[model samples]
Target chain A: MGVPFTPRANIIMTICLGTIACVVTSGCLLWFAWPYSDYERHVGWTVEQPVPFSHQHHVAGLGLDCRFCHSSVERSAQASLPPTFTCMTCHSQIWTNAAVLAAVRDSLLRNTPMTWQRVTNVPDYVYFNHSIHVVKGVGCESCHGNIAAMPLTYKAKTLTMQFCVNCHRDPGPNLRPAENIFDTDWHRGPDTPGPAALMALYHLGRRNLTECSICHR
Target chain B: MRCAWPLHVLPGALLLLAAGCDDMSKQHKENPYASPRSAPADVAQGSVEYHDTFHPAPGLTPALLQRGRSEYQAFCAPCHARTGQGDGMVVQRGFPAPLPLATAPTRSATPEQLYAIITSGQGVMYGFAQRIMPDDRWAIVAYLYALRRSQQATLADMTPAQRAIQP
Candidate 1:
């Protein structure tokens, strides 16, 4: 009877501990889950645009060059979006009445440019140039994956800093001949030189590709 | 008194954290080209050449043909070689080559016929009608004519400096 504390005190303490345990368990789960989530990387997630332009059909089926639409890729920092007039050139002749192309037709009618949503994006702080990478013999498929096979166009690789570091540390595997830059299915053949030889050919010496100034302005 | 404050703060912290879980599913905007505002003028559009309804433009000038050459390289060089020999990289890969634009029959083709072929394709060649504007088609046709003419040029066609450079 000398004990001042009752059984109710023990019950309260157990409940508080149980709640704390539950919270800690869920916190760990969420921490691991966020990176593995589908939305974080946007892999396999197709963005709906004014026109559901299929890179698969055009690049693979039709066999058109990437520069046909991304005209400034070779000369500029941006692989710029094709102007409305480029779409109108073909739309005005065929599929002129398709409901799906109504936005495209409306742009031509209203004289407005069509806006395409960007699929793969790096942070604004990071400065990436398309022309330099292209001139240096990096194939489109290196960063873009097998774009010819992508029917709906999604972010194939996570644009994380770690991902960038992995490539910058060693760009040999991603290197190809300048002539074969547009060849999506190109791979090193048995007769072809090794990655070291290719690196030598492209003049990619043992320089640090992952320097802070390399990407960060 | 046994950490009553921690219990009170825990649920509130959890509620705040749950609220911060952003929904990135709707990141992309719908109706990409639905904007009705007047489109910004394109610099390349200024180079386009449209054949008038009644009168064809006079003999192709060097400037006009140069614009045509660039336009052709951008749009036609993939399927039609820069030489207009229908030996583009796409054809070299395995695509069935279209008839060379510098052939005798192609040379005989009227500007309108060449425009139609570009707009409505032929054989296995798919139409670029939607992608290439009418004015650019005329530009390509003019360049094609120039290419054919250059193929048959004689020493008389060259200037003194050009003749000196000729092999």
Candidate 2:
């Protein structure tokens, strides 16, 4: 080399390169750790279903109630899937000849149930009751996101433990009147009671709201 | 000089990882939940083949009537009140009031005539033909009759059990 590099200069250059590497690596690690960066919560991710059911069409266009198909949401643990008969209620007359509805027809004729792919799931250790949440002033959109706008249903929320804990910690911002429980697009207005008041109004201020047994058991 | 291996491999590895994470099965666009375009009506009223020939479908069992009532509550109750009074929430929200089904002239109409009215839009009311099945339509007719009967029932019409529970 022309004029061999001094040992001090070489040491300084190595330190500078090492510092850049440390900063770049830490920055990347921070970005990846963000909860929203998880691919599952992002758009363009959809589960393949036997029948492509568009929530946007039924809920938005037709204005069908969430309870029309998910009947048990008001009183049961599971948001029950619509039975084959429910599909036949409309399909039996309309689109009877459409090729796309062949699966619906086959299931009816064969007396077999159509198994819709479950989009959102929770760990077995966690107990989530739909009826309790629905009756207690939680809106359908609170946890499910903008379901009426989804052309194809996808898991909107990450449903991470932190997500659940955040809501359980303070539910006022998410609470609505009993009448508006089904209104997904509900927004708190200037005159509306704040979350703290709603929590008190709904009797949801119980200290054990975050206890393990409240959900686990 | 820095080795060129990492420069070539790093981006390629990241791209491969991204590609690997993508699911290929969700590409189909056929969505049955979307309301398909209704077929164009070929023939109009007054044609020889277009005579008012719709009849009340038979097999009006108790179960069917029950199912009809439930279905009516789900589908019809939004515009037509559960009591058939035409004072549903939609009307309260400024929609023009529909004729009450419990009215004398409406209650007197035959089920077939009612079915025709339901299948075809009359005045401001749109047709429910694409939404309700023929069987369920008849079931709705049965339920309508039940609603009319309940509204017009006299004390004499009450059974002993009903009389006992009347209070």
Candidate 3:
């Protein structure tokens, strides 16, 4: 009946193994729980639409302004969607016979707003002002990226809180073509005005750009 | 006696691992904002235009106003007050008093102007840009107008057919 180790010793070994397994399980769980963002967190997302809209056709082909749909962006906080009437401003005469114009016509006849799925969405906690950012010289492309070239528009930047903080951390180099601040491809390398020049201009008589309270509460 | 050694060793190892992270606190530390903020004094005496992008929506509907009211209560009533008179308890307790919207000149402002202010906070209030989506802000603007009309409208305004047309 004499064993190498007592039965009490075996119980102790079992308890130790159980504790280690629990610790390992928790460690793995926490590893998965590490705070990575969701698929929508990426700036660019594509969704199925009622109609396949093409920014390339409207903007690049016909040279429509981004403001066409997001009309209130300059005088309002939002760059609101253009109602059916706005589409008809050009479409009613331009493409009245086109089969693709069904959604636009439906909105007008039914008096409903076109349901454009948000391709670019940020988290609720973040605060982004198109007006302030636009006025300050940040180009549409700075965050939105290369819009004229994009056929089907998708978000082009990682709009994470940290992504915002980095740009706000130093907003100097982001501004360009003051008049063409809406252009997506305004900034490029050494020959073009550097961030320091822009930062100096941005901060010329204004306050610091690093104030969290400026962007946050 | 030997069994106790591993237990003590495990905790010691964990403590060492934790100490290693303390060394990387350089980037993790919260730094005070490096630049000065725009002071209240810097704002123009008049309305400062901030709408860099403004697109017209489908306009307002009574249904939109109702939805806006529900959203306003959820997000804003904590501070802006249910009636939007800026009398919320949080504001009275010194949580940055919202501008009294009932008496606010904002009530007389255009829809776009009202939309701008709500989208991008007027003064002490920061923009609801991220908190409330744009459509919701537009809806809230519609509701704000409804609230003003509810206050200013009378039986006379409604019974216009009974009265003579204004000269």
Candidate 4:
């Protein structure tokens, strides 16, 4: 294509600049204003940490369990933040050399809990139940993603309302056996019931879906 | 100019169309207090329970009673006064008086009645249900009973354990 003869280049240029500015600003808005994580809080906003822990070390290399620390995911409302005792279970032998592990030990000895800045937090008014999701066959990765690979975990997925409803509406890809839900290798099994089968099942109550009250209350 | 028409017009048209198709249910993904119609409790179904007058627990132990008293002193004393005459420092200084529940009539009173009042609020006294959990509200009720009983127990019949707790 060749440049048009300059009959109206200024209007074209002004509109072009305005559109570029709008595009840039909207992109920023989506990054800053969009809430991520289970808490619906922004993911990149900084939070203080008491101990620098690595999931890559514990989850991937050492083959520890997510439920080992996030013990309440299969049980309660709050994923009961692990007590200092949960940490001492491993660090008692493993990495006592690290100053942060020493602080964990100190907090345990004094009967105080570490004020670990929570990642993947949700808003206060929103109630989430890991037990229901875990029991009902939602994979841990559906929200937390492949945490076994993340050393310092950032919010793995944007936990927007649409993200939740999209899955709720059509959860075929996200479902797995309740047992293997936490196992990262778990996937659509051999006979593989995908979204169409799941969509059909949704009508028959094989979906086991609930109304707002299950979470709201 | 070439970018302007598509930039303002195209995205706006797309977003409006997308939001309409999204999650048509009134399902609140983020509301914690969203009604639990999904798993409606057998008891909490359409019935609203009332807890108007504060009632004392009948067979509460002294230790439990004392614990309740301490909790009341911390939580309730701000409004209901140390003596439960509805004249705590809040009211003496500025706030509205809490209803005197001890003498509130029986046709109007029961543990359930008290529980309702605590949960739902009456006239000037706001319900404490959401402020405290179910177990804690029960604990406060038990203490209120102890408070009423203490007013009735003679100095002669009081146990040494009870006597030790004067304040």
The best candidate in terms of lDDT:
1
Query: Candidate 3, residues A123-163: lDDT per residue as tens digits?
Result: 43445578877667777777777877877778777676677
TM-score of 4: 0.45
State the DockQ of every prediction.
Answer: 0.12, 0.04, 0.01, 0.01
- Please give, for residues B130-150, the per-residue lDDT of candidate 3 as tens digits: 445677778887888777777
* Model 2 TM-score, 2 decimals: 0.56
**Residue A8 miss distance in model 2 (angstroms):** 7.3
Q: What level of docking quality does candidate 3 show?
A: incorrect
Among all windows of 10 consecutive residues in model 1 chain B, the one with the lowest summed lDDT is: B31-40
Instruction: Give the per-residue lDDT digits (tens) of candidate 1, residues B18-96.
Output: 9989754334443223343432333343233355253354456787787677668768876678888888766675666
Deviation from native of the Cα of residue A130 in model 2, angstroms: 1.0
True contacts kept of 1: 0.15
TM-score for each of the candidates: 0.60, 0.56, 0.48, 0.45
The TM-score ranking, best first, is 1, 2, 3, 4
Between the candidate structures 1 and 2, which one is better when assessed by TM-score?
A: 1
* Backbone clash numbers for all candidates listed: 7, 0, 16, 17
lDDT of 4 at A203: 39
Clashing pairs in model 1? A89-B129, A89-B130, A90-B129, A90-B130, A90-B131, A91-B130, A111-B39
Docking class of 2: incorrect
How many clashes show up in model 3? Answer: 16
Displacement of the residue B50 alpha carbon in candidate 4, Å:
28
Q: What lDDT tens digits, residue by residue, belong to model 2 across residues A1-217?
A: 5868988999999999999999999888877666445474553467787688888877776566786677668777877677666665456545678787888788777666676766776655677899899878889888888888999998878777788889888888889876567766778778777778878888888776888888876
lDDT of each: 0.73, 0.73, 0.63, 0.61
- The window of 10 residues in a row where model 1 chain A has the poorest summed lDDT is A86-95
